[model samples]
Target: MSSTALIFHIQRFSIHDGPGIRTTVFFKGCSLSCFWCHNPEGRHAYSEIQFVASNCIGCGECVYVCEHHAHQLKDGERFYSRALCVNCGKCAQNCFSGTLELIGKRMTVKQVMDEILRDSAFYESSNGGITLSGGEPCLKSVFIRTLLEQCKQQNIHTALETCGNYKWDKLNSLLPFTDLVMMDIKLMNPDKHKQVTGDSNKRIITNARQLVLTDKPIIFRTPIVPTVNDTIEEFSEIVDFIEELIELRLKRGKASTNDANIQLELLPFHQLASDKYKHLGQDYKAAQLIPPASEKMHELAEIAKKHAIDVKVR
Candidate 1:
């Protein structure tokens, strides 16, 4: 049988994902469950039903269409009974009002390639291509490798946005076809990282160390969460770590100070995905936290700059 992956979303014409314009394919499943994760729907490995209550309009369409009686209208409000749902996608198919929706679907490599190839003209004009994002794209290593290989066959530039929390062997297999790797370093402290993200930093740090050794360009990103991993001390430690990695590269004659193969991008925290949490029937733990002001982002950028590394606030 042809290999297929469970994917949550395919965002097109995206400027923030990579250079110029790009299409970001969000794969389902992840190793970590960070409290502030924006895409709660993407975390689960299996397909999930996302119920948007406000959009239902107390419509009985889902109840009528679902053969399993997974949906019920209770006192002018809609409720989705998870126990009865077989994930047949029947209710979602008839959901014209956009209340009940399936979050993930299986897609073959060829099927995904066709979707991205449709925007070939845009990619050519803007010097952009396909980017595999997640729920940790590396989780589905074989599927991602095949997709990356296919993209390369078509001369499409490929990038991977990862949290850097996967097995080293899995990542090594994908880099040969990847042109750029944008990884997130959520926290410098191992214990704190484990506390918030529910995973230790050992694996992520190790993977990144090996990733930089490769020829592909690397972009180190961090979502600056206030009172979590955002502190002057934390940023200083991060810069020091990057400086050490650059030294290692120089020692091996793999990179130079002027090479610009590595860069840092600080992503400000945002509450934009709070509603997504509600839709996914999950709590938005960071609801009260506001996005860091531009000035604050710049202030941290200055700290990163002091290490003589190219840094930007995105």
Candidate 2:
């Protein structure tokens, strides 16, 4: 069989992913189970259906097409039973209002490149290119490397958004073709990190140390979720760690004052993706948590700025 990847979405004209307007290719299958993950649909590797209850008009359109009896109308209301569904995409195919939809699609590098090339003009104009994000792109290492190689051949700028929890061998192979690396550092405390994200921070920290040794410019991100790395002291500790990496790069002569290749971005957590859990039949863990205030995010940004590194809040 040929190389195939389960891609969930292709977000076009994205700004926050990297510099300028870009197209973000979201891959499926994540190793971590972050409780506050905004993109829960990407956690699984297989193709699944996402149900948007609000969009369902109870028109019984899906009921007629689903051979597995995954969809039914009860008292003029649509009732979806995921247990019987085999994910053949028959019901989702008939969903016009996007009430029942498929999340992941199997595609090859050439197929995905067709979509990326469509926005080449926008990328060149905005100094933006293709960004591989999502359910941890590194989990699909070989396939990602192939796709990145194709992008390099086409002279398309490439970036990888990763969780940095995988084995180094997997990520090291893709680094050559990647232009920029965006990695998340949600929590510093190992115990707390495992509790929230369902994985230890040991591999993450080790991988980060290795990333600093390379010449690749990296942006280590921390999503400021309330009750989780949102305090000033904890944030400061993370900044201190980043400062250490910067110092290492400088000591090794890989960077100077002008070309400091390290940056810290503080991302504020929100409950906007609560519906994503409802769609995927999972609990919204960040449901009870509130987003930090704008002033607080700025305060944290200022704290990080005290160190000799770049700090951004969003």
Candidate 3:
């Protein structure tokens, strides 16, 4: 098993990811290409350089330092060629304007634990712990398992933020160390799911069914995208699935979601990551999609509440 993985960021004191304040380890790489993904940098499985044109000062320092001619100044404007860039990071290192950035870093379990131990006290006090989030943390399952093993040894609560597209065995092994599981159920129709996320929902739904049998806490999340799955009928299909899962757990003599062990969280889409897409030289195809108003979220939450499970709009 590999001990190191490509990590992009470690966000400390994160309140929204899990039960309490958490230290979220953001890994690089994903299986899905959700149109409204906030972390476009995490999409690639390898390290990448991000350039923000608006942040450029036209200092030509990057042009002066680039070895591959990736950075060029033509018509008094700086241009970056992703095809020519080799990710040596020399130009990013030399650029003084913070315009260029290397997004991913290779981290060992030991190195990551050093950072997690920093907030041990907060974890103990707030019921918060370590949450592994990513492009898809399971993409580096072996590495995540090692890191999560370290977390469990420390008696810290462990959680996962996954897309549920991996094979059942891949995720099953990590559940022993995970105290909570947060998986996305973006779309119900397999074809529609493939249309938006670039993958069929077959494996995801299979995982969800298997996950329901386990006693581990689970949170099913559906991001509310405007033109994608905003309708009551569409959203209700997801809620109906959750209700069925709760029934499945009850049949197995496990705690149902009604007892708070399982729940649904609705996340509204936002353009906060618009600039992130720009930085990554990728277009935000969902740019024109408007955010659902607060009242709309409340309405959806109410629609979800019609089921036996607890529903909350985040």
Candidate 4:
């Protein structure tokens, strides 16, 4: 196997990423630049630094360690001058407390599998498996495919959380080894999709259709952002699109009557990425982006239920 991936984090004991408890391998790099991305650090494929000023004790340790004077204290507050910083990671290495941190690391398939296998007992007990997520796993197709092959060799269930923005060929290369594909359907309107995600929806929709045709288990995830995609009409359009797909599959004899049992999950947006953006020296455009109200979430669920599609809110 060849080394070809830049991974950000390998989160263990994660319950929400997939079934039961899972070890999620977050790949670095993304095709879309969504306005309200939660994992901003994973957007870039290269290594980057994050400054968490709260963790800093004002000991001026980073300033002393930075030969380039990338860090300095002004008015008793430490400020990081990103322009002068070389991302050498010397400050992070020398800091006693985790005030400065580095994000994104390169890892090979063998190395990541070792970490996953270490927690095999937990995966077995909880029906958990390995989930490949990221900036976009499809960006590192070769590495993902190899990682999935190794996991299957160990009898580990594999899942992928994707933005569904890749070409059909790129996605199909990994589906045989993937047990579950959890994808995000950001918007149904092509122009609006581009406006919000910085990419057109043609590829995403095509890939999703192909996945459904393959009879692979797929979970459609929609993030409910506040002014972007949080209207009843928007939700209804998504529900209708999914229903149409099922209907089309039935017409083509690709799906059984029981296939109507497929469910769509609605994920309410949250502000978890606000601080992460600041840490990465990026602006938070959606600072006031609030999650949908509880009543609205239930209302959307009811709407999907009326369409005879199972709906879950998380």
Return the TM-score for each candidate structure.
Answer: 0.96, 0.96, 0.96, 0.94
Candidate 2, residues 23-63, lDDT tens digits: the string is 99999999999998989988998989999898987778899
TM-score of 4: 0.94
Mark the regions of model 3 whose C-alpha exceeds 4 Å error after superposition: 254-257
Candidate 1 lDDT tens digits, 1-314: 69999999999899999987899999999999988887887899888888887777765878988889888887876678878988778888888778878999999998999899989888889999999998989999999999999999989999999998978999999999999999998888999899999999999999888876777788999889887767899878888888877776666675567584888899999888988898877778889887889998999999988889889898
lDDT at 5 for candidate 3? Answer: 90
| Model 2 lDDT on a 0 to 1 scale | 0.88
Task: Record all residue pairs in model 3 with backbone atoms less than 3 Å apart, i.e. clashing.
Answer: none
In model 4, state the lDDT of residue 65. 86
Model 3, position 82: C-alpha lDDT score: 97
Worst ten-residue run, lDDT, model 1? 249-258
- Candidate 2 positional error at 157, Å: 0.9
lDDT tens per residue, model 4, 46-97 = 8788888888888887888899999989898778888998888888888877
Q: Predict model 4's lDDT versus the native.
A: 0.85
Look at candidate 4 and tell me the lDDT of residue 114.
91
Please, what is the whole-model Cα lDDT of each candidate in the order they appear? 0.87, 0.88, 0.90, 0.85
**Cα lDDT, model 1, residue 223:** 89
